[model samples]
Target: MDQQGNDGWILVETLGDAPTVIAEGTRQRQCRPLGNVYRGRTLALVAGTIASVQASRQPARVLLGETVNGIGLVVARPVLGPGGDVLAVQVFTAPADRSPPAPHRAAGWEWNLSASAGPRRTRWTQEFRKLYGVSDTRPPHAYFGLADLYRRVPRISDIAVLMERVDNARPGESLSGELIARRDDGTLRLVRFVRRAVDTPEGVTLRGVDHDITDRTDAGELAVRIMDSDVAATVHSVAGVHAALVDSYHGYAIKWITAPLPGLSAEVEGGQVSLLHGDDLGAVRPHEPARLPGVARVSMADGSWAPHAVRAFPVPGYGSTPVVMVTFSAARPEQHSQHVGRGRCAVPDCQLA
Candidate 1:
C-alpha cells in the first residue's frame, strides 16, 4: 500500500498529459505509475485502449500484457462532465481468462425533445454497422428520420415509442428495451438498445448502445419487456384497444397490454394473460397485416366467452410462426380509436362511460 493507504489506482484525465494516482493499493509498488508497470508492446496496447475508451465514452474490456496476480484484463469506464464530454477514465484490473462478450456497438443522435418526431442528426461507430449487419463499405448517413429508423428496427416498428419514453423521462433518468432488427442479409437478430437523454452544452442529446441479445433473452422474459415498454401506454393513448404479443406456437403468449379479464385465463403472467379459446397451435404465417378472418372468442375472467375483434400484424423473420402483435377491441379498428365500445369491457358488467 502507498504511504497514504489509498487503493492503487489512477484517473487518467482526458486533457491531462499523464494519469494521476487517485488511489494507491498493493499495486502501488508494481504499477509504478504505469511507466514501469507497462513496457514495450504492452505499453502501446494500453495507450490505444485508453484512447478508445475516451473516444467512445463507453466502457471497455481489454487484455493487458504485463502480469500482476495473473490479472490480464483491464476494464475502463469513462466519467463524463455535464457537457457530455469525457472527464476521466477509471481503470481497474480483471481476470483475462473469461471470453469477451459479443462486440458492443455504440451510436447516438441529436434530437429535439420538443420535436421528437423530427429528423435527428446521427452517427455511429464502425462496430455499430456490424450490429445491424449494415455493409461496412457504405457509409452511414449523418441523419435519419423516424420512418427510416423504424424501417431498420423490425421489432420496435414504433421507434416513436422509444422517443416518447425519452421525451417524458425526468432529468437524469435512463431507459432501456429490446428490439429486433433484420440485417441487410435478412438475418434476424435481437438487439437491446439502452438509451438515456443527457444534458449537453448545446442542448439535450440522446445516447445509447446497441448489442446483440438474441442468445440472451427467452420468450417469457421478452414478453415481460412489453410491460416495461411504452408500447401499451402508447396504444392506450391512441386507441383504447389493448395490445399483446402472441407466439401462437407452444401455446405461449405474452399479453403486453394492461386490461382486466372477464374470466380466468389458461395461463396468467406479465401484463395480461393468455386464454386461447381455439386451436392456433400452428405457427402464424407471414401475411399482410389484416383483420383476422373471424372474431376471437377469448375466455373471460368469469366463465363466459366474449367474441372480441382482433387485428394481427405478423412480425418479420420469425418465419412460419413469428410473434405477432395483436390488438383487441370490442369495436372495429377505425371505429374504436376514439373510444372503447360501450358495454363491451373485458370485465363483465363493467359498463363504459
Candidate 2:
C-alpha cells in the first residue's frame, strides 16, 4: 500500500505453511501471475530460480523477461513464519541488460574418421595418444594399416580366426576379439579390439577401440592349460565326411583340417576348412596308425564306421583361445592265427589266438 501503489506491489503470505496470495496492493505488479507458479512447486523448485531461495535470505541475479515491461534483475527471498520456517517467497524484478552466455566445452577425447578408398584420414584427440601410448614425436597414422598392424603382432598366426572375422564383417556390424601383440618395447601383450561400422553419406566409417587384456587373458589361458594338461585324454574337433587333413605336426594327428560342416568354416582359409570337390582326387587323408592314445570310433567317407583313438594337447602361440593338439590312430582287434585265421575278440581280451 503506497501513495501511487505502483512501487508497493503485491503482498503474499502462507496459510498452514502453504503459499497463498494474501494481498495485492497494485495492478502494476508483474510478479503476480507467478502466484500460481508456487501452487504446484515447493522449495525444490529453487533450482528454477536465478539463485537458491532460503528461509531468511534473498538471492539476486539477472533474469531475462519475455515482455518489454518485465525485463530486469530479479531478487527472490523466502518469507519465513514466526517459527523461522519458509512459508512463502517474495519476488521483485528490476531493469537490467541481457546478454547470451558463452559456449561450454566437454571433457574427454572424441574422434571422427572419413570412410574412403586407401588409407582413411582419422582425427585423433589428445586422449587417443595417451590411450595407445602413441609417442608425441611419432605420428599416429603409422599404426593405421591393418596388415602393418599384423607385423607388430607376435602371435598373428594364432589369431587368424579372429582376424578373418574382422575382415569379413559387414558395415554397421560390430565384432570384438582378443589377440597377443607386440608393443613398441617389443613386449608381447594381449589386447582386445572392438570395431563398429557406421554408414555415412560419403561412405562407411569404421570405428574401433583397443584395450589391454593381458591380465584377463593370461589368467584365463593359465586355467585352461592347467585343466587341459590335467586330463590324460581329450577329443579335439573330429574329422568327418568331406574332411581333409591339411597339416600335421609331430605328436599331433593334424594341426589343421578342412571339414564341410556348414557355417563352421567361413572366410577362414588354409587348414581351417577347405572343399575337396575339384580334380584333387589323389588326396589321401593321412592316417597315423601307431600313435593311438585312446580308442574311439569315427565315421569314414564311405559311410562305414571304424574304431579310432586320439590324443589331444594344447598348442600355444595361436590366439587367446587355445589350439588343441590332436593325434589319430587306427584301432585293431585280436585275431585267431592258426584255426580260424581271423577272429574278432568280443570281451575275452585274446592276443593272436
Candidate 3:
C-alpha cells in the first residue's frame, strides 16, 4: 500500500498483514485519530471531512474537531507533503464551557460639591435638578453655584450675616432660610434651604436641601419695606430733627435722631452728622460728653438729657451748630468711637455770646 499522503510518518512493512507504527513525533501524540476510512469512499466525502485536512499542492487549510475521552477538542490545519498529500496534523484544545466573571456593581449616588479660590458656577446632580424643577435635558453647567444663589437674594448683607452664623455653628447644627433664585426658564423661585457646613478635600462645602418658598419670602420682604417707610415718615414728622434707621444688636431696627433746632441751624447740623458711628454703642458708652463751645444740655423726647461735650464749629456764612446732631459710633466692636472734640461758634459776626 502507498503511504505517500502521511509525510511525517515513515512506514516500514514487516512480514505482517497490519502496518506497524514507529517513531511518531510529539505532534501525533497530542492528536487523536480520525475514524477509519474505506478505500471506496468518494472524493467529495474525503474533501468534506473535518479532520484538519491540507494539500501541499493547493495551499488550502481546514479545521477539525475530535472527542478525547468524551471531551470535545479542536485542531488547526495539518501539514502536507510535496504533492497534494496530507502529512501530520496539529491541534489545540480548550474548555468551551468556562466564561469570565461579571464586573463589580457601584454603590449609592456619586455627587460632590467643591470650593474654588474664585467664584464660578458648577454642574448640579440629578437630585438637585429635580428639586429645583429643572429639566434633565439641560446641561449640568447651567446650574448656579452658592455665590450666584446669594446674588439672587435681595439683601446681600443679610446673606453675609447668615454665613457668619453658619461658620460658628457647632457640629450637626444647621440653619434653614429662604433665598431667591432664577430658574433656567426665566422664572424666579424663593428656595428655602437647610444648610450645614461639611469639611471636604476641596475646602468647606455646604450641602443642603432646597424647597420653594417664593410666596412666603416675597410677603416677608414687602412687610419689611412697608415698616421701614412708616418709620422714616414718623422720624421726619418731628420738627427740626433728622433721623436715620440703624440695625439693633438683635438685627432689629432702631432710629437714631439728631438734636432739634431751628431751620438754618438744623440744616447745618445735618451736614456735620456722620452717617456711621465709629463706636459700638452696644459695647460701651462714650466716656466724655461731646458739646459745642457754648452749647448746653438738651433734653430728649423720653425726658432724658445727655450733655454734648464736643460740638460742631460754625462756618463763616453758615449758622451755628444745630442744638442736636445724630451720629453713629466710629469705633468697631472691639474699639469705640467716642466724643473727641467740641464745636464752637467762634465767628466774630455771631450773635450768641
Best by lDDT: 1
Task: Give one digit per residue, the lDDT tens place, for model 3 in 1-353.
Answer: 12233222221111112212211211111111222221332222223332324323222222225433322322233322211123222222223332212211100111123325222223344544544545436554443433223323333334444544543444344455554544545355555444444454655544443434354446556446334333433543432223322221111111223322222221122222222223422211212233222222333333433332222332222111112222222223112112323323322354321
| TM-score for each predicted model, relative to the true structure | 0.39, 0.28, 0.26
lDDT of 2 by residue, 92-122 (tens): 4335553322211101121123323433223
Candidates by TM-score, descending order: 1, 2, 3
Name the TM-score of candidate 1.
0.39
The whole-model lDDT of each prediction reads 0.47, 0.34, 0.31
lDDT of 2 at 2: 28
Stretches > 4 Å off in candidate 2: 1-116, 119-136, 140-143, 217-353
- How far is 79's C-alpha from truth in model 2 (Å)? 48
Candidate 3 accuracy as TM-score:
0.26
lDDT of 3 at 126: 53
- Per-model clash counts, in order, read 13, 3, 24
Q: List candidate 1 stretches off by more than 4 Å.
A: 1-52, 55-70, 75-121, 135-141, 156-161, 217-353
- How much does each candidate deviate from the true structure in C-alpha RMSD? 16.4, 24.8, 34.6
